[model samples]
Target: MDTAREFLENITAADQGDRVSRLRFAPHKPHAEPSFYEYSVLRGVRVESVRCGSTLYCSFTVPARLIDRNGKLSAGAIASLVDEIGAAAIHKCGKPMDVSVDMSIAYISDAKMNDELEITSRCLGQRGSYHSTGVLIRNRTTGEIVAQGRHSLFSLPATASKL
Candidate 1:
C-alpha cells in the first residue's frame, strides 16, 4: 500500500489554503501586500465596463495559484468573485458600499488555470435599504457557464454611518 500517495490524495483544498492561512500553520506576515488570499483570488481581474451605476463587466483569467490539486478553480475563489463583483454592481461612486446580507452560488462546472472568463453583475433592484444583485461567471471561449450567484445587501442608515 502506498500510504504516501493516499495521504497526499486525501488533502482536500480549503477556502483558506493550509500553507499561508493565518489560523493554521503559518504566522501573520503583518505586511503582506493585499495579503495572500486576496492576491491569489482577485489580483489579476480586469474591469471591462460599468453602466448606469448598476451594471458591471469584468474579465479574468483563472490563475494557477487559485487552483486545487485536481486543477479546478476553488469554490472559495468563485464565491469571492460573486461577493465582490456583486457589490460593485450596485455601488455608486463616493458612497459607502452596502453590506452583504446573503449570498447564494450555483457552481456549474470546472474551470482550469488560464481559462478566460467573463464576469457580469447587474443590480436586480432595491426596496428601501435592501437590494439584490445577480452575478454570472462564464467561459469566454466556450460560452459555458461556470457559476451563477445572487447576492443580497443592506444599506446602513445615514445617521448610523456618520463618522
Candidate 2:
C-alpha cells in the first residue's frame, strides 16, 4: 500500500474529527492559521509507505531553507520531523489524537542540504492512556543514521457516550 498517502489521509481525517479531537491532533487547522513548521519546514516530506504492520516509512530531501549556518540539517528541523512522523505512526495504530507527554532525541550525525532522508516510526505499545513510539532518521544515500527519537503520548478518552 501507499504508506505515505495513508499517513496523510489519516492526518487529514483526524483534522476532520470533532472539535476537541481536532484541537488535540491539529490545533492550527481548526483556526485556519498557518503552521510554518508543518507547511514550510516539512513541505516536501512524504510518507513513503507503512511496513511491518504499524511502522511508518517516510522520506524527504533536505531543502536549503532547513539548513543551518554550518551547511547541515538543523537540529530543530530534525526534531520537528521526528515528532510529526511519530504522531503519524501513533495515529495509524488506532489513536488518532493524542498529547505528547515526553519526547527525546539522539543526534547521530549531520546531513547536508540536498541529502535525502529516510525516516521510520513505529508504535512500541500502549498502556492505559499512555503510548510509546520510536523513530529513526537515516541518510538515504549513505545508509547512515542521522538521528533517533522516542515519543510518549497520552490518548484522550472519548468524550461522547456510545448509544
Candidate 3:
C-alpha cells in the first residue's frame, strides 16, 4: 500500500490544471450518497485544488440554506468549512487521520447569500503526533477576507497489525 505522502505526491505529479478543473466541475461523485454533513452544509462547495504539500484550496457559492437570519453566511457553516479544509491540508501533508484536538475560527467579515468564497488551508507544522493547520476564507470576487481558522489535530498511531 502506498503511504499517504506517496499517494498525495502521485496525485500532484499528474496534470495539475486538469485535476483542479475536474474538481471544480464535480465536487462529489454523482452516484454516491452525500454524507449527512455534506448534504446539510456543503451542497454547493467545490474542491478547487488538492495539491500535495501543506496547502489546499476550495471554493463555495453561499446558498440560501447556509444563510443566517442577518442575511450573511452562517457562522456554523463557515466553521464546518474551515474544519473540513484544514483536515484535508493536514492529510495532504502526510499526517495520519485522527480526531481534532482543537479548532478555532475568527469571523472577520460577512458574506451574503450567493457570494462566492475561496478557502485556502495550510498545514503550519507538525510536532510528534500533533499537527497544526490554518485556513482563510475570502470573498472570491472582492478578495475580502471573511474568516480565519486554526486547527490542532492528534495523529493516530499505526496499528501493529498494519505494521
Winner by TM-score between candidate 2 and candidate 1? 1
TM-score of each prediction: 0.75, 0.74, 0.71
Which of the predicted structures, 1 or 2, would earn the higher lDDT when compared with the native? Answer: 1
What is residue 25's positional error in candidate 2, in angstroms?
20
What shift in Å separates residue 20 of candidate 2 from its native position after superposition? 31
Q: Please give, for residues 1-163, the per-residue lDDT of candidate 1 as tens digits.
A: 2443354456666632663343322343533434445554678899999887589999999987679889999998999999889988887666767889999999999899999999999999899889999999999999999999999999876566556
Q: Best candidate per TM-score, number?
A: 1
* Distance from true location, Cα of 3 in model 1, Å: 34
Off by over 4 Å in 1: 1-36, 161-163
Q: Candidate 3 residues 21-140, lDDT tens each?
A: 543223555336554465667667788887767788889899886888899999999998887778878773343355789999999999999999999999999997789999999999
RMSD in Å for all candidates: 7.3, 11.2, 14.0
- lDDT of each model, Cα atoms only? 0.83, 0.81, 0.79
Model 2 regions more than 4 Å off: 1-27, 31-34, 92-96, 159-163
Residue 145, model 1: lDDT of 98
Tell me the deviation in Å of residue 11 in model 1. 15
